[model samples]
Target chain A: MTDISAQDFHDALVAHKLIIPVGVPGAFGRGPVFEDVLRRFGDLVTEAAKNDTAEHMLFPPVIARRVFEKSDYLESFPQLAGTIFSFMGNDTQHREMMNCVHEGKPWGQYQQMTDVVLAPAACYPIYPQLTGTLPENGRLVDVQNWVFRHEPSPEPTRMQSFRIREMVRAGRPEQVADWRDMWLERGLSLLRRLGLPAEPETASDPFFGRGGRMLAANQRMQKLKFEVLVPVLSTAKQTAVCSFNYHQDHFGLLFDIKTADGQVAHTACLGFGLERVTMALFRHHGYVPAEWPAEVRKVLWP
Target chain B: MTDISAQDFHDALVAHKLIIPVGVPGAFGRGPVFEDVLRRFGDLVTEAAKNDTAEHMLFPPVIARRVFEKSDYLESFPQLAGTIFSFMGNDTQHREMMNCVHEGKPWGQYQQMTDVVLAPAACYPIYPQLTGTLPENGRLVDVQNWVFRHEPSPEPTRMQSFRIREMVRAGRPEQVADWRDMWLERGLSLLRRLGLPAEPETASDPFFGRGGRMLAANQRMQKLKFEVLVPVLSTAKQTAVCSFNYHQDHFGLLFDIKTADGQVAHTACLGFGLERVTMALFRHHGYVPAEWPAEVRKVLWP
Candidate 1:
């Protein structure tokens, strides 16, 4: 791997017109080359998981406000949620908001919260849909969705709105654990097959506040989360390209999902950060996909 | 054509689990069959447009606030814009917002407009990026994006957020008009082949207020917009499943786009509402894909 600085790689990608800056931190429009590779990588993932017999589901970026509240996401990552606001006002209110816009004042005051909030994760909505008892095999859903987190940064990988491809499994505890473990191995193998130096390491979610620290530590101790990290940004602080999360009945208990044996189902998910992995590929193999390694080319494009 | 009421059709869809109501007026999660048909139709559109040699660009559902403002969408459709609001505040503000949530009071005040707004159209962001001279053949962009509108209704077709697949062309007036006119025929033919009984009719956008009424009339008089309508929702009122718009120097002037000979470029776009067309298919050819006509199934699935 080329020992290029994160800033240098970002600048190089921007210069090559692979990532177009829209004057917002972590909200850049990906250029054609970046899109092509990202999509091809998505296809590779589909190919890898073709035989899983997972039921495919697609959700919009926004989730219902009630479901958002039900997830307790606000209690955990209060800072990272995106609530949609709209100008649901009368004619007089509209004119007043127009005046504010003309004066360059805050017009957001006139806007009210919509019934939806930007989905913080790909799997949040699926839980509510799986409220009843699952089949004997439980359930496996293949989903790819746009997710939002409010952490704006100059770092290219830390996008505010990004796509995540996930395979969510809901079943008995052993089934969930086995799936998570299988995915941990498969994810690493898949990434390494693409010549990425990916490794699985225990990780924790960025929970909010002092109480969150305890929860994070507990999660780590219980080995609830594992991430496949690659040194895309910097060797000192590798970025998470893939995550394997085992939510032992958290979603089941919340959504009242039940197992075939009439017990609260356990849940687990394997998420591939589409943009981050694409970035890692570009970083490792250089910005040009045509010049990428032959085996990588065959694996992605073929 | 079936003489089912809009409410009846909507109820049928919900009962069949094609669309899952999330307790929101317009926002609903589509079930697996609905998703399957939607994606296959997307593939059909891509197949039909493959020979156009258009550069495919995929944008996120959110657009930069500056670009959104530049589009003057607020001036035209102030009622139909969705703005993203985020909790960008200090710890104290966060606590206050949490208290508001806990008490079920208004907490939207704690949220502020981000640099991005919900993308009102699939092609809005493309114009700003094309702020330069075009080549001899101009530019053609094949874009499929999730778009937002603030109209909330129980009508199954009138989703607040939906996907639109569009082909945008920017060049001389003749070139733009020709592309629009060609797409008008092609879109109609494509829809007809799918047994939609689609027809092209003169149309105008729902521009805002009194001045907007004049503008809308002017648009219809100039024949600037045409919609391919299908009797999906009601027999008396056909729904627009495809739209062909010739924006003669409007986006060009706004974005400073020019032609190869240094003249102002004219722009035109043809958009297919993915959800509307899919709904039309289900309405015309039963809700179940397996029971659909063989020809239609072959066209969509094959």
Candidate 2:
């Protein structure tokens, strides 16, 4: 395990036919075995969270352009956002595009922005829906959707398009904090139960620029973010498989979400990187599910 | 039901809170009840198809740009393809984009095309994977993924981005034809079992321009495509809930897929529009699932 690098793990996964490479760096297809394990893990997560009466919603991978603008996501992480573009043109423009294709020139210039942007996170759209006052206790939502980022690397864990299963809570500050902490413990235990050496550590979003560095430091100092780490690619530098974040009132203020008491709602979310967790299972418990520990098998297959 | 139009149905869905309007036509979020019904319906589909022994594969919504180029999709349906664009620029270009954003100008100019395109169908990527010789019985794959088309309309069923569950088969001509006919019947039966008055009719892809019209007419004349139609928005004009297509060496020739006996293979696919079927259920049955017919409930929830 100590000798395994990210490249080695990626190659092994490809060789074993678990992942079908699409010739892109971080974008690939999951084979039957990989999809089976991922589906089971997702179901296991749903079972674990069934106790909480959270409203489940499903959104497509794209969000409205106006929502993306209001989220101020580009200002914080401009490099990572993916904006959708389509060829909204007439026949003449179409012919020009085809000519560009024939001539081997850049035809993307003819494409224009659509009304949507690839969603950066599963929980971003939920805030817009939370406008106005919430209930006294809070509002909780369960979201599982595809998210997009522009970062493309050879590491299989860092996929450009991936799925995130998230639980978002918006309400009073104390309630949000308690929920975040509770989920932090629950997420760690859930992963550990699956036989991964999972641990919680302070984390920060990869904010951009000089000011972003200061913000990252402040976030870390305030213990605003925690990630459950597992040695999927390398034991020396574990990958973050689960993230719990407390965004005090960043989203609440932006979306005008208020608590029943009329104060700005505090928000927190716990997200599980579905692919990373599945990869971690393959790494720790062997590629074959039948060879995995019986306890893990029961926990997943049950 | 006779007087209900597409807009009326959309308004009803939004009013019932089953669908969350995202300020964009043909794009919306599914609320809890809607999601619950959709999940159950997806499970029912999987259960019905389990006996086929098809290999299941999951791909992201976007596919490699090269694959899109090789598929000749743009030639026939250039207007309906979504080309993903990203801001792969430096600090200076980023500043320019922010300036455009602040000034309310078109900032999409700063974006560049990535190495991928939004997939137009669930089976497009599967063709590329079946490049070489197949087994004696050919190969069958089950794919369920998000697909994108650039058609924007007020009709909720005409979503720009939607999910499609497809079973793709590639082999000799007779084998392909038999599989297509088999699935066409299965699709009709499954929809009928759900208590929908479903029927199969000849169909054709919406090819572009005059040449495309000829291609479409020829397709219908050759009996290459059929659709399972149900009255969703209008009783007069039914909607296509499922599609069955037979590609006689179209994809096989492009991908060089050969049979085990050293001849070119043929391909066919049967696709179910998951969202459309769920919407049809809501349209046919009462908006409330509990009040729906018990037989329908038994089929879905079982």
Question: Which candidate number has the best lDDT?
Answer: 2
Question: Compared to the true structure, candidate 2 yields what TM-score?
Answer: 0.97
lDDT of each: 0.86, 0.88
Among all windows of ten consecutive residues in candidate 2 chain A, which has the lowest summed lDDT? A86-95
Q: Model 1, range A1-302, lDDT digits (tens) per residue?
A: 54676578779889877887776677677778888888888888888888889987778877788888777788778788888888777767777887877667778878888888888999887888789999998999988888888888888898888899988999988888887888888888889989999998999999887778998999999999999999987787999999888889889999999998899999998899999999999888988899999999999888
Give fnat for candidates 1, 2 and onward, in order: 0.43, 0.64
lDDT of 1 by residue, B215-288 (tens): 89999999999999999878889899998888899999999999999999999988999989989999999989
- DockQ list for all candidates: 0.55, 0.69
Candidate topping TM-score: 2
Candidate 1 chain B minimal-lDDT segment of 10 residues: B20-29
Candidate 2 local lDDT, A26-72, one digit each (tens): 77999989988888989988888888899888888888888888776
Give candidate 2 misplaced runs (Cα > 4 Å): none
- Write down the TM-score of every candidate: 0.95, 0.97
TM-score of chain B of 2: 0.97
